[model samples]
Target: MSIQDFFIFNCLEEKDLPLLHRWFQEPHVKKWWPVPKEKEDFFDSYLKRIHSTEISLYFVSYGNIPIGFLQAYPVDRSKETWLPKLPKNTIGIDQFIGEIDFVGKGYGTSFIKKFIDQLLAENNEMTVILDPDPRNKAAIRCYEKVGFVRVGIFPRKGDLALLMRYN
Candidate 1:
């Protein structure tokens, strides 16, 4: 389905923490997004990090149902010291379908493309990027469907990921 027909991006809020935490605990989400090892302090750390960072966290809703979480950040504002050289207006994104029921559907590609449309509309010259685990074939294909090309592989915390970019 087309994005306008269903998908909506909503900025995250404190009230969504419990829902976010529950999603993170799901096997599908936990496999990809391993939050703090200390589950007891996950919310504490998450709140501090989200509030203090220069990133935007959003929930992807499909037909009024929240099904996923997405986060975007400017590469230059990142705390990572090993980030490769990126364009001046590069925006990086990471996302996952938090709701298991939504997995394998066409929502991911459509939602991401729509989000990119919004970003590019705001700044047509800006670049969009993402790093997905090399083994994540599904994610790689979804990104490719959205017009992002694989730049190269990059090491992130001892794990290798493919750096995909869209201009």
Candidate 2:
């Protein structure tokens, strides 16, 4: 399905809390990024992070259903615990489909493309970065299909990820 038909990009808001927690706890997402967070803690942290000028969080909605989360950030300014270093002024994405049933459906790829399209519309000259685990072949292929080129590998904190970019 086309992005305009299946998905909507929106700023994360208070009313989205329940869905956010559900997304956080999904087995698919938790398998990759585990956290033992209570609902309030998660909400507070999400709010605090998104309020920073260097980051923007978007809730990925598919026909009014909260299906995933996406974030764009200036890599140089992030105090996030695990992000890799990138060239100054470059932005990167962190995204996932929290619904297990949606896995392998190619929705994540569409989300990346549509979100970047919207971002580039706002700033046509933006450079975008992505780092997916070297083992996630599907993700790597999908990113390449969306025009991001693999640049190099960066191993951070025992995890090795393939860094890719679109300029």
* Candidate 1 weakest lDDT stretch, 10 residues: 77-86
Give model 1's TM-score versus the native structure: 0.91
Which 10 residues in a row give candidate 2 its minimum summed lDDT?
77-86
Error of 1 at 128 (Å): 0.5
List, residue by residue over 20-53, the lDDT tens digit for candidate 1. Answer: 8899989978877779767658888767657967
lDDT against true structure, model 2: 0.78
On TM-score, the leading prediction is: 1
- Model 2 TM-score, all chains together: 0.83
RMSD in order of candidates: 1.8, 2.8
Global lDDT scores for all candidate models? 0.85, 0.78
| Candidate 2 C-alpha lDDT tens digits along 1-167 | 56656789888777776787788787777766655567778887777876777688889988888788888887764453455555565788988888777778888888788888888898887789888888878778889888899888877668787889985
Question: TM per model?
Answer: 0.91, 0.83
